[model samples]
Target: MAFFDDLSHIGFSTKDFYKSTELYEKLGFELIDQEDNLGSKVNFYQINDLILEVYEDKTNSENGAINHFAIATDEIDKTFAHVKKLGFELIDDKIMHLPFFEHGISYFNFYGPNHETIEVCQKNKE
Candidate 1:
């Protein structure tokens, strides 16, 4: 049996959809579509296979319970460099090889707009 199919998407909250869209676009995300009727402050973005949702709700705190999200890339350095060029804050200067489950992975974390942490990881080959 297949343990899992794949990650379809992850939802994240934001105070302003337009601002969040701008931030994500700077970080290499493309604006796919949005629902203006849903509310004045709700929208979504599609970055490759990832679907990021941003919602505007003053009642909800912007702390974002979801601390971080990650993307797997074959060219980690190139991807990291592109992100840096976009002016996003790199949290750690050094990449780390973390041992998890039955294998090890190399990754680095960075801060995105809205104080959200984003991780880029490359899995080690056996």
Candidate 2:
């Protein structure tokens, strides 16, 4: 059996592509490309190696199992500052320290477009 390597990309359905793109951009993602098919729209953003695909859908229901997604960063503070400057309110003003994780690692949550909770974290250097 071939073992899986890693997650290469993730897709999120949104009603507003412009709003979603703006929110992702504030989090350090850059708009890579977009596609339009039969009146449906899809936008793609790249943050380092990770690719985020946002699809504009009108029939998507509000209730979903997944609360949000996360993106790892080396410079959490700088990323947080960028998000703050874009007018996004952090869920907590303090950084969360997890004993289970590596030392110096910190994380905080913020709401994205449509109030989607996004967890941004930094891992300690070895």
Candidate 3:
């Protein structure tokens, strides 16, 4: 089945939230949303259909980088099944909603063979 319909957003782990926010802003992205997540600040930016989500790295470690990207899907159940059939390891098989957004978003993450985190999600129609 065709699972992912489009690229939703890219997630990034950064040492400085405001600094990273400024960088993306310099690149022509505007801040669209922000929320507290896991003791870190989650910032979402947008430039048309392209989006970037940056969250502070709690450990402030050297691992700060592009963490993951979420793909928009209409059929969450079928996507999960197909991703599993392809042998990707599920991180959490549960659908999660973002409290920051007024509209609903249901998604789950799975790790590729190389451990790259990817998300398949059903986001509200705009």
Best by lDDT: 2
| lDDT (10s digit) by residue, model 2, range 12-114 | 7787668887777766689899899678898888888888778887787772124777789888788777777778868867667665555667788887776
lDDT of 3 by residue, 34-122 (tens): 89986789999887797877887756554445456666678877777777676556898776677445577778887632344667778
Candidate 2, superposed: residue stretches over 4 Å from native: 63-65
- Output the lDDT of residue 54, model 1: 72
User: Runs in model 3 with CA error above 4 Å?
Assistant: 67-126
Higher-ranked by TM-score: 1 or 3 = 1
lDDT value for candidate 2?
0.76
lDDT of 3 at 36: 93
Task: Determine which window of 10 residues in candidate 2 has minimal summed lDDT.
Answer: 60-69
Poorest 10 consecutive residues by lDDT, candidate 1: 56-65
Instruction: Order the candidate numbers by TM-score, best to worst.
Output: 2, 1, 3
Local distance difference test, per candidate? 0.75, 0.76, 0.70
What lDDT tens digits, residue by residue, belong to model 1 across residues 1-126? 898887877777765556677887777677776765455565677777888777665565756547899988877778877877777788978777889646788888888666778899988775
